[model samples]
Target: MHTLKVDSVQLAFNDRKILQDVYLHCNQGEVIGLLGRNGSGKSSLLKIIFGTLTPSYKYVGIDDEFIHYGYLNNRIAYLSQDSYLPRGIKISDLAAMLIDQLYWDDFANLDIYKNHHHKKPEQLSGGELRQLEMLMILCSKADFILLDEPFTHVTPVETQYFKTIIKSISKTKGIIITDHQYYNVLDISDRVILLTDGCTKHLKNVDDLVTYNYLSGIK
Candidate 1:
């Protein structure tokens, strides 16, 4: 079973603290949503999990095994708000770069990759590009996936599309996602972790989140 366990992780940047005593646990068939306001270290935490950002203090694990920052580039898949795809790169080639026919064939059956078969990453619209990036992540060999603001630039339809993909991924893989779109996040998330003032509090349900004023517009 794919699982991600982050224990007592702490991080700082340029003498400023970002994450303090952070801990997270996720497993297959579960969707964990990381929620917080802007500049609240939401993305930083995701980067720390994916090893893109080095932590001043930390311990992140996967399947009970310790994970190192240097080697996480290949072991985890990350989708950022920016498509960040290389300009002029072909979409088919990008997918191929992640995985080959054996994996692509299995991944393509998922609804997210249906329309992204051969489209160029640069030629795609914002939604298409985001979807492509997500599809690539799904097809990769990474045991854990970190998605940062996947619905930020996409349309409502695209948002729903990606949500379905996320739900599907959680059924077979461990996924940690952060999005400002709180409503949609709640709709798909099996568990919600609210980050406030650099601390995390797990909410049991949507009502719990609302009662705690974690849901937007409820305060």
Candidate 2:
């Protein structure tokens, strides 16, 4: 089983302290949610963990070994809010680049493909683009998947489909996702990380969310 441990990570950008003494732990077969307001270092922490940005003190361990970002693409897949599809690429091409069966007839049955009619990335709407982005990410076979706002701009139906896929992925892989859709994320997350002013705290249950005002009122 895969796992990640972040020990007292700190990062700064040109004198701005983006992340401070943050710690988090996620286990295999678990989906963890990272929540916070805009510019609160949520993405910075993810980047530090994934090795995108150099942390002031990066103490990231996978399973039990310490590693760096140079090898992350082979071990983890990070999906940003933007799709990295080549400017002239088609949906089928994007899937093929990631994995073959992902663009097969089985995946074709998905609403995303059916609605987009296998259109080129540049021609698709934002929601459709993100769906394609998600497909590529899921097909990559990475042990750890970090997704930022996976549901943003997607339709409700598409969001449901994506959530199902994420759950399935978590059955075999570790997932760390951040989104503005806190309630929906809480529904699927095995653990929740709430960030405020550069500090992070783990929320154990839905009750904590309600008690901490992270929710309107738990359902």
Candidate 3:
């Protein structure tokens, strides 16, 4: 089966080690929820796997073949917390470029885009823009996607909508997602893992999150 794997990931800034001996793997048709406390290197790890950040050391591979440039390989997509789309482009134009034409209607039907198809990213509210950005990434041709803080600015209703979209797309894509909203992550994940002390810990249950101090307690 196709898989994206990152092993022996080591990164540091000056004397501070951000990540070390970290490992993670995700296969096609699976959603892996990544949870961590603030400063636990979750975002940095995603950046390293996506090839946007040059770590001190890392081994990223797809199906046992080491990939030198993850982003340029056409097999990986990343949705950063910050806006990555061009502000001047119309929503329809951007959607056409990233998604298949057959899926255009499905994207257009989304509440976030239905009324703003002709508007530019700059004209949308923060929540609207964020939702649009996520939809574009999810609809991309890549087989593996990394999403950072996807639920940050959206309402609870919108967050649930995004989760449904994610589940639908994950039927053919491997997704690695991280957000401060841990419950949402847990809700959508096929499996969940925690990053702590520069290592990855496979979680067996929500209680494990509390054990690792990633959560105050199970809800």
Candidate 4:
């Protein structure tokens, strides 16, 4: 099975350390949920693994082979919190560029695509645009995907739908997803880890979230 591993990820801003000695790994057919509070360096760690943000130190590898330009590699894809699609581009055209032709029919059949296939980014609402962006990334050629705050600005139904898509695609791809929506992350992840106090902690159960201050209580 294909595996992506990131370890010894150390980052700092000026004199303040953000991520220190963080480690995470995910193999194909697995969705690893990442939980962290605001400013816990979750996004920074992802950027470091994706090679978009230079950390003080890090070791990133796939299948035991070290890679430098992670983002440039076709084997990995990173979907940032902000919208990645360019304005004025039709959804159909964007699909042509990112998604394989074999999956074109599947992509076209999605509810969002069926309604917005010919429309530009500006023509769709924020949630609609987010759904389209996610579908494109999930269906891309990348074998590994890093999703940052994918549930943001999306409705509960949309969030659940995205979870289903993530689970389905993960049969062939390794996914590492992080969001403030902890319950959703918990429900979908094959395994969950928390980034707390600049380290990674394996979560045993829902109560672990509370122990790590990720959640107040089960409620």
Candidate 5:
């Protein structure tokens, strides 16, 4: 199985520290749920892994090879919190550039794409645009994906469908996801990780979320 590893990550802004002594690993066919309190640097960690943000110290690798920048490798993908599609681009053209050939049929068949293929991104509703951005990343050729707040601003039905897609995609790619909707993250993750005080806490179960003060109680 392919593996994505991030270790020895350290980040700080001026005197304020964000991440230090962090380590995380995900294997193909597994989903890692990342849970943390606000200002815990969850997005920073994902950015570091994606090579968009440079930490003070880090060692990232996929399988046996070390990577200095994630985008350079092309085997990793990231979904950010905000919409990223450019203007003046048709949904169909965007798909042609981003979606993998192997998953083209499945990508083209999604209601979000099928209905809006002829429209530009700006024409769609906010939620609809979010759905399309996510699908493009999820259906890419990358073997490892880092998703930040993926479940935000979507309908309950869309959230559940995204979970299904994530689970199904995990059969072939490793996924690391963080969302304020902790339960949604928990629902799909094969393994859960808590980011606290700039370190990674590998949780044994949902109860650990409460213990770490990420949640008051687990129902």
Candidate 6:
């Protein structure tokens, strides 16, 4: 099984320390839910793991080898909070670039792709584009995926649908997902981590969220 381990992460912006100490581990077939309040550095942590953002110090690796940049060689795929598709790129071309051969038919045959493959990113509505981007990231061929606020701007039905997709895809890829929609994160995650005060806390159950005050109480 593939393993991704990270620890000893330290990040700060000017005088404020965002993350001081953290440890996270994931292997194939696991989905780890990351929860934090606003400005808690959940997005920064994902960017650090993906190598898009430089942290003061960090240790990210796959197996035992150090991974300086997780995005190199498609070792990991990242879906940031912001839109990633460029207007100059065609939808079909982006698909050819990111989708694995084994899943091409499944991806190409999706109604969303069929409806938008011929149009530019600018042509789709904000919500439509977000849906397309989310689908593409979840379907891309990568050993691991880091998703930041994936459910944002998505409809309730789409949120539920994507939750199923995430769980299904986790059988082959290790995934770390974070979003303000805490309930959705909890619903699909195999295990959960709450980031607070520059620390990582592993929760034993729903009650732990309460302990951290991340949630008022169990739903």
- Candidate 2 weakest ten by summed lDDT: 96-105
Query: How many backbone clashes are present in model 4?
Result: 0
Off by over 4 Å in 2: 70-73, 100-111, 114-119, 210-219
Kindly report the root-mean-square deviation of model 3 from the true structure over all alpha carbons: 1.4
Candidate 5 per-residue lDDT, tens place, 186-205, comes to 99999999999999999998
The deviation in Å at residue 164 for candidate 6 is: 1.0
Ranking by lDDT: 6, 5, 3, 4, 2, 1
lDDT of 2 by residue, 33-122 (tens): 988878888777777777877876978888878978823556777887766777776676666556545336656676677776567878
lDDT of 1 by residue, 32-82 (tens): 888887877998888777777887777777777788762355667788776
> Which runs of model 1 end up more than 4 angstroms from their true locations?
70-73, 100-103, 106-119, 210-212, 216-219
1-219 per-residue lDDT for model 3 (tens digits)? 589999999898897888997888999999999998889999999999889899888999999999877788468999998999897889888887787565677877887778888899899988888888899899887889999999989999888989999999999899999999888999999999999998999999889888888778776
Total clashing pairs for each candidate: 0, 0, 0, 0, 0, 0
Could you tell which candidate, 2 or 3, scores higher by lDDT? 3
| 107: Cα error in model 4, Å | 0.8
Candidate 6 structure quality by residue, lDDT tens digits, 67-176: 99999998999999888998888899888888888778888998899999988898898888888888888788889999999988899999998899889889989999
Per-model CA lDDT versus the true structure: 0.75, 0.77, 0.89, 0.89, 0.91, 0.91
After superposing candidate 6 on the true structure, give the runs of residues whose Cα lies further than 4 Å from its correct spot: none
**lDDT, candidate 1, residue 38?**
81
In candidate 6, which residue pairs clash? none
Task: Give the alpha carbon lDDT tens digit for every residue of 123-212 in model 4.
Answer: 999888888898899999888999999998899888888899999999989999999988899889999999988899988887898888
Q: Over all chains combined, what TM-score does candidate 4 have?
A: 0.95
Better of 2 and 5 by TM-score: 5
Model 3: what TM-score? 0.94
